[model samples]
Target chain A: MADIPIRIGIIGCADIARKVSRAIQLAPNATLSAVASRSIDKAANFAKANGFPPEAKIYGSYESLLDDPDIDAVYLPLPTSLHHKWAVLTAQKKKHLLMEKPLALNVAQFDEILKACEENGVQIMDGTMWVHHPRTYKMKEFLNDKERFGLLKSVNSCFTFFADPDFLKNDIRVKPDLDALGALGDAGWYGIRSVLWAADYEMPKTVTAMQGPVLNEAGVILACGASLYWEDGKVATFHCSFLSNLTMNLTAIGTFGTLHLTDFIIPYQEHEASYTTSSKPQFNELVTGWVPIPSEHTVTVNLPQEACMVREFASLVENIKKNGAQPDKKWPTISRKTQLVLDAVKASIEKGFEAVEIVS
Target chain B: MADIPIRIGIIGCADIARKVSRAIQLAPNATLSAVASRSIDKAANFAKANGFPPEAKIYGSYESLLDDPDIDAVYLPLPTSLHHKWAVLTAQKKKHLLMEKPLALNVAQFDEILKACEENGVQIMDGTMWVHHPRTYKMKEFLNDKERFGLLKSVNSCFTFFADPDFLKNDIRVKPDLDALGALGDAGWYGIRSVLWAADYEMPKTVTAMQGPVLNEAGVILACGASLYWEDGKVATFHCSFLSNLTMNLTAIGTFGTLHLTDFIIPYQEHEASYTTSSKPQFNELVTGWVPIPSEHTVTVNLPQEACMVREFASLVENIKKNGAQPDKKWPTISRKTQLVLDAVKASIEKGFEAVEIVS
Candidate 1:
């Protein structure tokens, strides 16, 4: 006697939803129940192209998807500016919410969505797939080991991708009216989240935007960076860009060890992911080489990271629905913290790159 | 027939000298001819313990070693404060010089040493051995390839090592009267040098130090970082510390490719070094993984990087000695540029983390 799968409805035909739809199919605990696009023909085409189940419903408008009583949750991959409106409505309709990150335009918008989810007793989790990867768990274990890693000292994370000319000119990310936050919201989100994750979610004392951020004519960021400082002498810096090649790096250093990975956001292969770690490395006798070199750890993924993310989210939703339990606060709490740091970095840049003290 | 090997005398019995003495012996075109210390017994012991030639002379003072006509060049590993004094003396004595990095306390002091070398017609090179590694040349080829790497966009380099309490209290690096720049010089040197190497030695337009630099009681920096901006929208940041586990990372991103290495300062093994490069990598169709994944390149070394450095320096000295060629200006020019950026970072920190414009 297996439990019924969580029925997940995707409320937008965004490019990212295509991947998430596949993930929903791959996740054993979730099933694609519905998909919606503003136009009926587009919704039908997306459903047909993405291999939506024969029983999956196709809706011309997001409101219809939210009204579907069979749907247990909604995966919202809308642009940043639209998150608040749709996320709040999805929560009001009592559907669990799985939202693409830059969770909201700012913390305030995200707070409203959280409030809605709380009032409706619905689970909410941001769509940051990497955190759910089994490899991430192994890396966190390394970071938390007192004998190996000791106290955390610093972190440096970067996520950059070269945006082709047509995309830069027309992509919703570069349009101030649509995504608005641009590269910082789209890419810097991962960097900020990685830093916070490395620090065990301890908020930094201040965030300072690095000089020379590149912006488009519409006042949207194309490339940017920021440094964060903690009261206890820990420091981190992150850089994100749409003008550079695809490179994702996360490096965390502790008193006695270091952890590094280049493909933090996306694995190089679907079935496996790997990271490198060094603990108490020493120089060779002649000082010409490392005595004990760093070691690489690879985690075999039974399912892709995105599918793992879907399974985790759907499991939370099932707990809330089938067990009559409250919505999980952990996911929303982490999402809000990431958005808080993102806001600070943007505010610091707007205030002439001055230090912005994080209130929380 | 091969030309006579360059006879190199080392001034100062610093721990680094023991390694370089071995390098000089291993270098095909160099031979250790003498060593000097404030105490003749120390010099004699170092010469004997480091396998210096049995006929090698032992001098009680640096001045005496500089005066030895049989020595064609000198390796200077004295404290940073003494670099201005001994480096100038080595050049004035017409001995080609291989001096340790953080060439001087400031560019002004380094410029004076450069002037002395110019006037004496002696070659001078800093002991930044990694640039001489064969792997570095391979990496450069990728960076310079337009089809593979495209235009350089950013770089992030870090070098850190945990220092015991004894070193924090007694090491020359932490003493104001000795290596006054502290970790900013001793550890930050490699970070800055790596950034410069990745950027093709092009000077950045501005240097801004990151906030929250940790300083000792004597106002010596124990940890610090900076961001450098180039006029062409290229950016680079580096962090260096004496308070974290040994970690060296160099990540460079271009429009079409990325280059990364974990042990950029010292190879993990004496016989070979490796780096990773991703050229025009693409996400898989479902966005769960990468297509045409990154490739690792390994370069075998016949001798250690330090030996390679010594051989290159000795070969330059031989060219000037036997071919009547002028001393190569390339090495000093790069050393000066690196020092200039370092000075700007220090100035920026002192001025409350303001951005400091680099004149040259």
Candidate 2:
């Protein structure tokens, strides 16, 4: 809280890690004190490129990086297959952890990480940076004003993109070690998490899912859809696809009206949204003089120079320093619940879209 | 095929009958030959007001109207409680039948109606007017063009409105004879039928549904939702609400892009629709940038005066005149399939959103 920079270690020198590394240096109370990767050259290159301080340690392996006492926290940008292992190990080392989008391949693995964090008295957070973004928080604020939209009725979200064949060879997105987690986990997770968060983390009472299996590759699910329901009759429908051209859209419908976000997954320099009432009654009655319901709004956000990941990690470190881990304690529960929903999606796919209930 | 007029009898003086009567006058080859209601005065008043020939028979009851041999076809706009009764009776009377939607309360009733029409050599059709609209046909055109939108992914539809308390008092929509058929039969039928029609009548392999029970009315379901799955991994979702204020919107998403129609039930005269590819490299990127991908298009259609009933009756009459009966029809088969889906929706609601498979 007093502007003391929190020491941080980088677990991988991937593209995302570089961006986060730069962000750490820019944050007021955070320092990127170390770098690690499977390749020594890659780690040393990243440390030199970022101008790591003299005290900054360079390690050839993630385990050795976590062993550094000077590194107060860890940022895990490992491949999808390695997230759970390193996340649990980082927690066991008593280092606060921030792992990428999906916390694990399945609910069981996520629970293990949660248990590790609990036993070690360390914090674990899924690096869902979008949730920490102000625009998403703004959308949540708009949803809370019942007078504006009435009872939330439904949410529909889509996140899709085409994957390059070359990138597909060794990419964790196409690898089987991740265990049935691909588009739904990589791209679809943002859409799913947005819906769940918009609904105040209320677990869907029922879920039905369908996925297109990859014909060219074995054990690859390319496109997936799921419909989740709440006890109060609210429904959320989501679609994630890796074989399609790029697209990201989210729509929330309520009894009174509907709201749409043109780009949900990516942080747009200028984001656009629209809201329309159910009836368009006045427009109908004034047919001769009718003007289209001006239903769109575009907002420009001045994002901080820091990467969303670095900002979130720095925030967590500051929270730990101020409140001694209480602020970072709620994330494991959220991450575990998300993994459970993902597991339900997989079960539904395996059983021919049989409706699966999230047991909480 | 010639310009020969078909004589039609109206078997009810309800609001729907008024609309149909007007459509018949506007149709080049359809004649309003008779009018009927529970009260002779009401029948006579409707005939006179609608400019039916002075000699046109005015029957006090539907039975008498069906007995009129001069009436080549009968349009039935009775409540859901009466649809099966009148449909079967019309078929038994050897009259081509046009029945309003939900076809019947359940699959068994629909089967009975189909059997009755088969035995009597009569044509039967559900008055599902939405599919008959030119806009719907245009939507189908867009869907069939693979280069434009690619594979169908999902269909979302909503049909909801605030009903006058007076209309809800004794109306079959609010209080159907069979307790199982509530809003799921009334407005929900349209939403379900839309999905079925859009999906090319490929009955979902499985369906899961949930409904909100009417607070003051026992055995009445108000709001309902259902998630449907197709064998090819396509998903469809439908939502209907009775207590909510008026609103209707439908959207269909595909692999390449999305098609959005604001008012699913009754679109405004100036209604426009647009298609946009998600911000990735769309398969049709070259084509999209050249023309702005046509965000929206306004289609001109003279909303058929009595849209559903008129279309159904005209189609049945044409079929009967061509083949001496309502030719063992494709329309009837489609209607039967929709009824089965609707029945599954009801079953799922009754079982607390349990999955229901659509048996052939």
lDDT of 1 by residue, B209-325 (tens): 999999999999999999999999999999999999999999999999999999999889989999999988888877888888899999999988999999999999999999999
For candidate 2, lDDT tens digit of each residue in B1-360?
575677889888876576567777766667888988999999999898877877789999899989988888888888776878888889899888877777888889888988988898877777766666666777777777677667777777776654557756665566746434667777788888888877878888988774343433556767777878788877777777665545555666666655666555555543333233332243231111111222565566664424434655675677667756536578888888888888888788778767788997
The 10 consecutive residues of candidate 1 chain B with the worst lDDT sum are B282-291
Cα lDDT of model 2 by residue, A1-360, tens digit: 367777889998876676567667766678988999888888998888876777788899888988988877888888777877888889889888878767787777777888887788776777776665566666676677677667777777777665667756666677676534777788768777878886878888877774343323757666787878788878777777776645556777665555666456553332332333332233343221123442555444444323555666677777776677554656667777777888888788888767788898
Task: DockQ for candidate 1, please give it.
Answer: 0.88
Count of backbone clashes for each model? Answer: 0, 4
For residue B187, give model 1's deviation from the true position in Å.
Answer: 1.2
- Show pairs that collide, candidate 1: none
Taken over the whole model, the C-alpha lDDT of each candidate is: 0.94, 0.70
Off by over 4 Å in 1: none
